[model samples]
Target: MTTQKIAVLGPGSWGTALSQVLNDNGHEIRLWGHMQAQIDEINNNHTNSHYFKDIVLDEKIEATTDLKEALDGVDAVLFVVPTKVTRLVAKQVAETLDHKVVVMHASKGLEPETHERLSTILEEEIPADLRSEIVVVSGPSHAEETIVRDLTLITAASKDEETAKYVQGLFSNHYFRLYTNKDIIGVETAGALKNIIAVGAGALHGLGYGDNAKAAIIARGLAEITRLGVKMGANPLTYSGLSGVGDLIVTGTSIHSRNWRAGDALGRGEKLEDIEANMGMVIEGISTTKVAYELAQELNVYMPITQAIYSVIYEGKDIKEAILSTMTGQLKTEDEF
Candidate 1:
């Protein structure tokens, strides 16, 4: 593979971890963050104090607040910004990016108002001809575990197979495994919608439901994702792969998931606003729930689990009532949909 300078926009935990991997592989890295504090900590202290707190960073990663400076001389860009912030961040990056840079995103979830995927936003933000370089890397990776050097597998999906391989090569490490696929739509959709299901599973867990309940919800949730993904021209098998079932299993079961934690609070009788206010960080599931709910309605898709969580979060319906409604109001075969 050809060597290239990598620019990672967004200094959050996932971005920091990915930048660390690339830096460790001897690639020059330029890191960017909207917050001066994040930029300063990465540049001066060689650590992301706010995000990857306890984890030290590589010396080769140079942090900057200037988007132009970060993109300068860089061959590829990894966008790790929040889903809601994707459009704004991509616009800034595109303004100064003169050369065609292979773009990769680690963000999951959709824009609530638009119900658009991250890649869809990228297409609108970047010039049309340049969008073939857009790649999506997603799977069961938890940034917390990645920072601690835990083994994780992720998929690099793109219309351009060569670009996918380029990103795969950069991210592959002792503990990080990378795979490439052409199913960008399926992978991206699964990555976003899985968060909504994770929230539902977390609510079940927080309500003291056992493994059987979690397992059932998770399996059913995968069905919902597959139904929508297949209808949208995504490969059916992609939903059965790491970016789909693997991600759902990990995020739905792991406590490290912020989305799941937010749902836990809700399951324990806390309000959505209260949980979100206390968490500080983005609870992607909240926004994802809204987007998935709206998309399902528009597409005429059946997403019971997503709808249940959406009702609890948006319609002010009681969590217990939502759960009971789902449990008692269904009696169809698995293949009915």
Candidate 2:
């Protein structure tokens, strides 16, 4: 394997973990973050206890607060920041770059204001010619499991097939595997939409519901999101692939999911502000819920599960009441969409 220098923006759990994976693959990585304290911890202690406790980082994975210094000579960059700040960071990177580079983002969510996918936001913020390619990386893998190098499967998607394969090779290792796909719209949509359902799944867990109920939520949630995805011009079959159902299963069930944890807190009758303050990490699903809800309304797509989750999050609806209404309100054909 050819050694490459890569810069990873965001020292969060996901970003840090990915940097470690690339560093282990023999790439020199500059892991950049906004926080000086976090960068200091990573550069000095080789561990970010807040994000990945007890997991030591690769010393080759350099940490920095200066974006220009991190991007100085890197051949590629991974934008692993929160979805909300993805565009902001991309703008900074775009200005700093003097040559074309492979730009891939692992963020999942629509821009709350524009209802734009992360890729779209990247395009809007970064000049087209400066970026050799724009790609998205997504799947069911969690940062907690990934940092330990647990076997994980994910997809690298772009409009350009060759670019997708290049990204696939960048991250794939014995334990971390990536498949290439051309369905960028479907991949991004499925990845973002799954978090809304995962929030609902966490609500079920928090409400003390059992397996039968959770299974029902996952199945029905997929149907609703797929309908919306199809309406948004995604291939219907992509919903059956790894980025769709594969992601929903893991995000909906795992304790590592911030969206699920937020929903769990809501299920236990906590306020949104309280949940956000406690999590420390941004919960993508909460903002994505607002975007998905508005998009469904604007696109005229049927998304009952999304509606229920949105209500529980934004409308201050009781979690138990919201779940009960969502489960009992509609009785259409299973594949009505």
Candidate 3:
């Protein structure tokens, strides 16, 4: 296999884990981040202690604080930054790139202000002449497990089938696999919306709710996600795939999910500001809840679960009250959109 030079623009948990995957696939990787100390740690110690405390990164995975140096002569760029900073980083990437390369983003969340997907932000910031069709890689995979080389499967969605296939080959290994999908909208929507449900699930768990309640949240949450995604031009079946129900289940149930953790804290009476300050990571669901709530209203989609979570986080509503209201809302059929 020919070794490809790839730049991973983010040294956060996901970025660091994916750099290992590319390194394992015999690729030269330049892991970029804004933190100078983190870069030093990855280069000298071969570990990002801030994100992954126990795992040692591969020695070949070079870490850099310089964007231009990271982008120089790379075949593709994988962005794993948080949604809040995607546009800023992508703009920097656009200014630094000297040649065209396949651009892929693994970040999941709609832009808080614009309610736009990360790929859209990338396309707007990174000129068409400087990159190929944007690819979105998302699914049930979590960085905590992925960093340890656990078995994982995810989707690579793009408008261009060849590009999706290219990404599939680039990241696949014995433990890490990629499936190609053409429905970029569904893949991205599912990826972003699931985090909100995960938050709700965690809140349910924290509020002393049992398995049945969590299960209800997951099921109804998928219905809500599917409703909005379909309204946004996503394929309904995509919700049944890895990026949809699969991701929702793992994230909503797992302890490793930042969104879940945040919701748990909120359910336990912690303030949103306190949760954000202490987590040391971006809980994409918090911002996503606001965006999804607004978008659902604008699109005239019924998403009671999303509204409940949004009320708790944004409106300062009591978690128990918000959840209770959603549960006792007007009667409807299970299949109602």
- Spell out the clash pairs found in candidate 3: none
RMSD of 1: 1.3
Ranked candidates, highest TM-score first: 3, 2, 1
Please give, for residues 161-188, the per-residue lDDT of candidate 1 as tens digits.
Answer: 9989988998898889999999999999
What local lDDT score does residue 116 receive in model 1, on the 0 to 100 scale? 78
What tens digits encode model 3's per-residue C-alpha lDDT throughout 1-337?
5899999998999998999999999999999988899999999999899888899988999999889999999999999999989999999999999999999999999998899999999999999999999999999999999988899999999999999999999999999999999999999999999999999988988888899998999999999999999999999999999999999999999999999998888888888899999999999999999999999999999999999998888888899999989978999999998
Best by lDDT: 3
Tens-place lDDT digits, model 2, residues 1-337: 6988898998888998888889878889999988899899999999999987789987777899998899887888889998888878888988888877888999888898888988888888788787856889998889999999999999999999898988888899999999998889999999999999988888888888889978998898899889999888899888888999999999998899998898888887788898999999988899999999999999999898899888877898777787778768758888787
TM-score of each: 0.97, 0.98, 0.99
After TM-score superposition, what is the CA distance of residue 304 in candidate 3 from its true location, in Å? 0.4
lDDT at 89, model 2: 87
What count of clashes does model 3 give? 0
Decreasing lDDT order of the candidates: 3, 2, 1
Top of the candidates by TM-score: 3
The per-model lDDT (C-alpha) reads 0.87, 0.88, 0.94
> How many angstroms is residue 319 displaced in model 3 relative to the true structure, after the best TM-score fit?
0.8
- In model 2, the Cα lDDT at residue 290 comes to 93
